[model samples]
Target: MPTSILRIDASSRSCGSFSRDIGDVVERSLLAKHPGADITRRDLAQQQIEHIRNETIIGYYTPGEAMTDELKAVTLTSDEIIAEAKSADILLITTPMYNFSIPSALKAWIDQLVRIGRTFDYDGHSFTGLLPGKQAYVVIAYGAGGYSDDGPLAGADFAKPYLSFLLGFLGIQDVTFVPVEATTADPATVACEVEKARQNVRSSLDAG
Candidate 1:
């Protein structure tokens, strides 16, 4: 079946971002795999949403409550972001590691979409995810060094694990990570790793 794919980019360094370059390849791979798939690209670097405020939060939670014109205008964008995520069959994220974490823009987007009773709900005992049957693919690029989820540095980091946890909480346990590491290792080595990542993406698509 044809799918609706949402491609999100969270790299700040426009043309020079390795993650963006890799993300393009991933998008191309997706298109080749599913010729009928529709793609929606959201570049966090370019079109970033401001951090939600207290008023925006109030507006988001107030179902039928009247809001000031300004509040309504701010909340509308958040509503659209939520709608896009909910409607997508899959989400592909391309992000560069900033100080060993996710970019602020990406975090801001999450804040908007992760509304109570929207993306998730608290049952009697625990919170249950409302979004299901969706898959996600994450591509992470590092400028220096590398860290694994089980590595010592991973515990101190909020980028990778936080993203995984939030998405998993949203019923997307089938998330996959394709990390392009060792950027500071050597220029040649970084190029090789990037190629390897692209090849892996191609192979995955081909298998599908």
Candidate 2:
């Protein structure tokens, strides 16, 4: 069977977005490895996933046999989102840092995916993620420099750490990051950063 890849784009910009361009590099590299891979692209900016609501929360706790039609209608989006995630072998997420963390749309999507009795389970004491044996490649674009681990402003980078933890919570332990930093720098520097991100994608895919 062919590999299944879920590509999620969280960048608000429709064109000339660093994160999207880097994502293209990742998609191409993956295709080179798995020519007939099934690719599912979800553009959060265009689709605009709604934030979870009270009805959705109620649906989560309600047992399947006890769920009402109203609750089911409200929770259908979450069900679809979780189904897509469950069907993927690899996840490719591309997002530019927004206020030192992930975009609101991406966060909303995460909230929908991390549900009890679906993606994860808690046995009164311990928690186990239902979705395992999957890998993730996250491409993060930063407007300014110094957010890398060795950079001076590394302490302020909440995006990377948050994503790392979130993916692990969902049982995706094999996660790689491709950083595109200093995008607000001069034209030459921006080009260099983009090229570096491309090379990083290639190298990570090669290693994988």
Candidate 3:
């Protein structure tokens, strides 16, 4: 069977976006491996998903058979997002760090996907993820350096850890994170960082 890839980009900038550029490299590498892969692209910047609402929360807890039309309508986006994730064999997320975290649009997308009894299940004691056997690749762009373990600003980076935990919570344990740091530095530094990120993407794909 052909591979299925869900590519979600969270950068607001259309042009000169390092995250998107790195995503392009990742996509190309995947295509090189799986020439007939089915790729689904979700550009959050252009088509932002609405944040979860009160009605949506209520819809999640309501039994399917007992859900009213209004409740069903409020949770339609969540349904679609979960469906997409369920069908994908690989989840590719390319996002730029915003204020030391992920962008609002990306967070909204995540909120829609992390639905109970849809992507995961809980019995008050333990939780189980419904979607397993999927791999994820996350590419993050940072404006300033020092987000890595040895970096000075490591503690300030919430994007990497949050995403790592989120993907694992969704049963995507086989995940690779590629960081593009120091994007707002000098042109030479920016170029070096971008190249390093590209190399990381290629190496990761090659290893897989």
Candidate 4:
């Protein structure tokens, strides 16, 4: 059981967001296993998180001690986001597939958290991730395809592979994907998929 949890929701729709609802379930399940675990939530749908800009990139390279006020201001949010994840034993993230990939807000968060020297490092020849021993679960709400590895149009589904790669880059090897597919499909299909996602969440906790 984890002592701390980081929950992030990146769905655009707040009212009819199926991903957010499932994400809440994921959080609750984690909490049940680790009762009273400290949870830090970042709802990108309700907040305005700016995408990575050139100033941010420049600031990331600057040392903290030597960083100018301008650089610090630009990178503060990213630094805080990274710190939150670094403090968590587990991360629960849910993102609705936007045009076959993750939402822009989520991607921006990744850009900030996946820092070069902070979260990872390149030693001349090889790059090594610094954050380790942390687990992550990502809930994918897709309109079509991207659910199964052998499913049709697998190439079209970019969320899973991209997320897997990025999280792995950050030294998070234990990652779970609980996908609720076909949200734009019929109600029965949506319900079935939602149930599958919930079962997957339960199985993850049970296995843990």
Q: Is candidate 2 or candidate 4 better by lDDT?
A: 2
Flag the better candidate by lDDT, 1 or 4.
4
Total backbone collisions for each predicted model = 0, 0, 0, 0
Off by over 4 Å in 2: none
Candidate 2 overall lDDT versus native = 0.93
lDDT of candidate 3 over 1-208, digit per residue (tens): 8999999999999899989999899989988988999999899989989999999999999999999999999999999999999999999999999999999999999999998899999999988888899988899999998898679999999999999988888888999999999999999999999889988987899667
Shift in Å, residue 83, candidate 3: 0.4
Candidate 2 TM-score over all chains jointly: 0.97
lDDT of 1 by residue, 56-172 (tens): 888876775676787879888788898899999989999988877898999898898888878898877998887899989898987654466465565656677878999999988
Q: Which ten residues in a row have the lowest lDDT in candidate 3?
A: 199-208
Stretches > 4 Å off in candidate 4? none
Model 4 over residues 1-208: C-alpha lDDT tens digits? 4499899999888888888888888888887888889988898978868888999999988987899999999999889998998899999999998988899989888888989888999999987887899999898888874468677867788889999988888899999988888888888988888888889888877567
What is each predicted model's overall lDDT from 0 to 1? 0.83, 0.93, 0.93, 0.87
Give per-model CA RMSD.
2.1, 1.0, 0.9, 1.6
Clashing pairs in 1: none
TM-score per prediction, in order, is 0.90, 0.97, 0.98, 0.94
Writing each residue's lDDT as its tens digit, candidate 2 over 83-196 gives 999999999999999999999999999998999999999999988888899989999999999888689879889999999988998889999999999999999999898888
